[model samples]
Target: MAERLADWKQSLDVALFATRMNFRSHLVHPGEVVLANLGALVQAVSGAAVFMLALSTTGVVHGWTLAQWAVLTGFTTVARALWNTVFFGTLDIPDMVRSGELDHYLVRPANPLMLILFSKVDTDVWVEIVIGLGMMGVALQASGAEVGAAVLLFIPVALVGSALVFAAMHLAVTSLSFWLRYDAMLSMLVWRFDSFAQLPMSFYPKWVVAVFSTVVPFAFVGYYPCLYILGKTDSPFVWAFPLAGPLLLIPAVLLWRRGIARYSSTGS
Candidate 1:
């Protein structure tokens, strides 16, 4: 048990160190960082602005209230932002494959996937987390939901689960690049697919929900979890869904392993 605990600690330390290095690497341009972050703030605020303006009409969409929609927005925003900021680096597999850059990761002593995932960080987009949380807090207050330790805990847990779910989808799609080197258009669609997820799954048709629930599990990414967060539903699936998210990682990792084995490297 002690050895296992130490192993976990070591992994955590390495991950933290890699993330810090990646963060610093992106911060080298102070002027670029400032201007980019300002643009990010405007982008985030504009998205929220559009949502509020649209909802100002019906006061609801697909039977969810403004405040509930706010929670949903927050869930989607934070989860997507988290993935974009931290884990999206894994999507660079194709570029690495083409440029021979991935050899650096393969030569490292640490896990190649870890090196790839934490290999990059976006300092400019980091503020999206704050914006998302602000949306949630304001929406929760407007809805009169109790703000306490439990809610606080659930929000972070939900955010992590949601982000992982999205990342799993991304990783699985990205792995395809190793096999389908010429299919850039298809892979590009993977990230854009999140636009469908921003709204509650209820807004979509039955088939859409079915695919999201079973295949990609985008429902668990934000929809059902948002329901639980807002006290709207008590389905055991809502609670179990997020916990089961990492299960998707099993297949994603398998794909990564196979893809790496298949990788011919630019030198070859």
Candidate 2:
């Protein structure tokens, strides 16, 4: 038992070390880092200016003061930025599989999925996160919202939940590599999903909301949690809804594991 415990701890340490290494490698990649930062800056400036202009035209947003809208938009922007930075390659699984590079990944000591997910970091996305927080702050001030301890407590839970949702969704798409000869279709579909994700869920039809929320689980990306932060929903569900984002991983990871096993058997 002691030996087994030691082995487990050693593995955990290695995994943590690998994660740090992955982050360090990203910092060293000057070209990718610069491009990412530039993209992020553009997104942030464009989003903020557009929102300000739209709100100014109406003189108030849908029951949300200008500040409140900024908060929601801020969360949305930061969430997308973080996901793109960390898991940008999830969409490339199909290509990886087709090129037979996935075979190499499977032989590595660490988890293939983790390696794939953390391998890339576009530092430019940080711009979006920064701008997003700025927007949220503007919203908070406009809405006159108080920062109670309870609300602050929910922030991390919500953030982590958002990350999980991202991983789960990306994994799900990548798993198709096991079955499809090409993932061009999946890539196109997931990118389109991004635009849908950007829109406020309330603006969509009820069925559209249902499809993305329960079926695809993208709503958890921003809408549901943002609603809770806005005090738009008080259901105990809101407190726990963020948790639902990561829950998307259960099936996605399981499917990926199963697909990998089949791939191993086929040697393809």
Best by TM-score: 1
- TM-score of every candidate relative to the true structure: 0.89, 0.85
Give me the displacement of residue 217 in model 1, in angstroms.
2.0
lDDT of 2 by residue, 1-268 (tens): 9977776565555556766777788778678878867876886798688868887777554455666667767776677767786678677788777777877666766677767766654556767778877777777767777767877788667877776787788778778878877665876677677756555677678999899888787788777887777777678878877777667889988988888888843355
Residue-wise C-alpha lDDT for candidate 1, range 128-216, written one tens digit per residue: 88998899889888976666675577778878888888888878887887888654556678777877777788888899899988886
User: Candidate 1: TM-score?
Assistant: 0.89
Model 2 clash tally? 3
Compared to the true structure, candidate 2 yields what TM-score?
0.85
- What is the number of backbone collisions in each predicted candidate, taken in the order shown? 0, 3
lDDT of 2: 0.73
